[model samples]
Target: MTKSTQGFCFHTATSSHVEPLPNAKKAMAILRAAGMKKINFAGGEPFMNAEFLGQLVMYCKETLNLESVSVVTNGSKVTKRWLAKYGEYPDIMAISCDSFDETTNVKIGRGTGNHLKTVVELSQKCKEHGIMLKINTVVNRYNFHEDMNAAIEEIQPFRWKCFQVLIVPEENGSEHTLRDARRFLISDDEWRLFNEKHRHQECFVPEGNDVMASSYLLLDEYLRFLNKGWESRQKVF
Candidate 1:
């Protein structure tokens, strides 16, 4: 399941206090019973409530015996200590790094000055802890022109997934959301060009809007299944 948990610090108003651990554990059991083997935690910054996220990760691996468990993060809030404790449980740690350039990353609203540095440090820690690293890049207006080959090679992630910046009405394109991402939208040709430039990398995996739209089973913070619509996610589990 992609976006297995939806509370993110920067995107949604997901309160850690409101999510019941017992209910979440029950949800995991349901997924396991349904034959779901791999689960990825995304939607909001998983580290916002490190304890909660760690518990879920450990449960998926140790108790549920899921084939693979992963989490995607912006790499700022991750700490070495956290990895030391729970890293063994996660099969992969995918860090979002849109651009290697710090300025470009800041412009893209990824984080402050040290975004790249944080990703590098986190990648190293994941390596030490035996968690395979993956790099996720969103190709947008601010970063489509930049070359990320060197930085990605340096990090040496097992996979380098690049995506065309997608604009969903209520998600990132509307005023009601935390981020208005229309300005970041790029043309199909631009997206293709970005992929073409980096196609030489054996690890490169690019996904455009259409492929990204229908690819995954997305769940919100409330554990409601999110269905893709022209504008927003309109359905429930």
Candidate 2:
């Protein structure tokens, strides 16, 4: 339910063809007008343009006075200096760590061999800056059986979310797409098993396809509304 509180956007997809700042302001105004009080910035790795992302976070809190502003990142590009400058704006910083094992993480394309290390470091920095830390794990074929309890316990995030691997029709399901996530997808039983394994963790929250399908109101790079089902880009700005 925490996810439904915010709308998500792909920053790089929109930034490619438009002036990011103005477009961002317009989008934020529209969202605010629509009574959206919380917004989350996702990628194309938002931290790629750290300053731009920081500005948007600041504008949401200071200018629009949004109730919550969050960022979902891979944690590879985040730096201590950037956190010091802009960390105060975001209410939560969620790092994607698919697996606790470094080898499995690298194979899943989270980062190189050091992604787990980066996540740990970023979690510490977020704590020092008084920002809530969250971990997002996608339970795909490669990481379905991993026991992440020890690492998650060590990090002690405010929330630890596990998502069943979903394959959108035009996005990641087909061979033509950049990611053929068909191979990564796990069965419903596998997802249930994975959740059962971590049920003891206090912070753990598991989301299956049925829940994820209708929960999000996503805006794509072109500022078009996206639904995870048969409809793609239901509305455009």
Candidate 3:
């Protein structure tokens, strides 16, 4: 199967309450020494730590000289000044947008409301700033049947990623982390039907469980290399 990862993906933390790692600049030096060509900074919301996030992005682009430095954000705290100050470094700015409707987003725990509005504005800012904008959509029972063709066409992101909602064995099986997601699970046939509609879109990119499960290299908040998502084991520091 194909993978979404080409280089490094740094997951700062899972929630806003979790403290960020110390010595970010030093970590970048280590990654640069390891010859990382691409880097992605993710978090409960990386923008929550705006100052550090901006500096780290610059470090990757200017000092490490990585081929690409990008961030995966929820598009809530994005602002023109934030983009202007740190936009020049990253090659792609990705946003996680699941539903186009306001209520649907709240129901799915993606956001409170007005998510699509924020995304739309951010899309324009990305274009204005010359940053390649990408949207990552996690398909689930909530949004499986909704037709997003019109909205997608309007935004015209450089790349549109559609992922089949993932339920890891360690997560959705026992009930420790996030097994409740099982309520929103969909079958292969259901996913294919959804994909068939947008398959014609030139920018559409699709990923099934196989790709999302363990294909990418993920670094945890402590800068430890985790095996993969939810079911991750064997943390290599």
Candidate 4:
């Protein structure tokens, strides 16, 4: 049940646009109390609250004596200096990249042309500064069949790359629709086959305790746990 041996742990907070709540300081206190040292900042997008994020990073590094820190980003709102500063604090940067192809990237709601390019460039910058970089891809039916290998190839040079099977929450407020869910839903057998096909490369299954939904924490400038149902899901295969 402890975090490190269990894998990773996640905490969530409400976004500024969504509601008013406790700030990042309170959120960090809660996480520290839970015995978490490594933390991640996720949101509608973390960069929206740049100053607050910078403060949080500084506080966690100095006050909590954290071992590692990370942010899951979209790559659009970050600057080279911000990335560099984030790197200095020993934080890992994981950018959400569904495809390396621009048209496909935009079609999937990521953004217009050169978004992936920007991410690639930023990732390189992160490497130059010795910050860990990870590419996070959400595999779905449209892009799952053919693009997986190419996505891997595009991101292979980075420090880490991860593929997550899309999960649809049954709850009414879930952002995922049944149609979107169906597009990405693969059976465990299919997942095994996909793994086998790409078995030549290293792949990471979420550590026993570090399930993405569980191990990391997300907040607005004011931190809060956004999704509560995630903690109750059955174990992923």
Worst 10 residues of 3 by lDDT: 1-10
Q: List the residue pairs that clash in candidate 2.
A: none
121-195, model 2: which lDDT tens digit per residue? 889889899999999988989999988888888999999999888777666667665456777878899998899
Runs with alpha carbons beyond 4 Å of true place in candidate 4: 1-15, 18-22, 84-86, 147-163, 168-182, 203-222, 228-237
For this target, which candidate reaches the highest TM-score against the unseen true structure?
A: 2
Residue 100 of model 1 has an lDDT of: 87
**Cα deviation of 203, candidate 4, in Å:** 6.1
Q: Rate the local accuracy (lDDT) of all candidates.
A: 0.78, 0.78, 0.74, 0.55
**Which candidate do you rate higher for TM-score, 1 or 2?**
2
lDDT of 4 by residue, 133-212 (tens): 77766544444444356556665644434454434243212344212333345565555565555555564332211264
RMSD of 1: 3.8
Error of 2 at 43 (Å): 0.3
- Give lDDT: candidate 1, residue 175: 70
The estimated TM-scores of all candidates read 0.88, 0.89, 0.85, 0.71
Error of 2 at 176 (Å): 2.7
Q: Is candidate 3 or candidate 4 better by lDDT?
A: 3
Query: Mind giving the per-residue lDDT tens digits that candidate 3 earns over 1-237?
Result: 011121111221233342244556676777678767888887657787787788889988998899988888878888778887988888898998888988877777666677888898888888888999999888888888888899999999989999988765443434454334667788998899889989999999999888887666666555556534444444332
Q: Which stretches of candidate 2 lie over 4 Å from their true place?
A: 1-18, 227-236
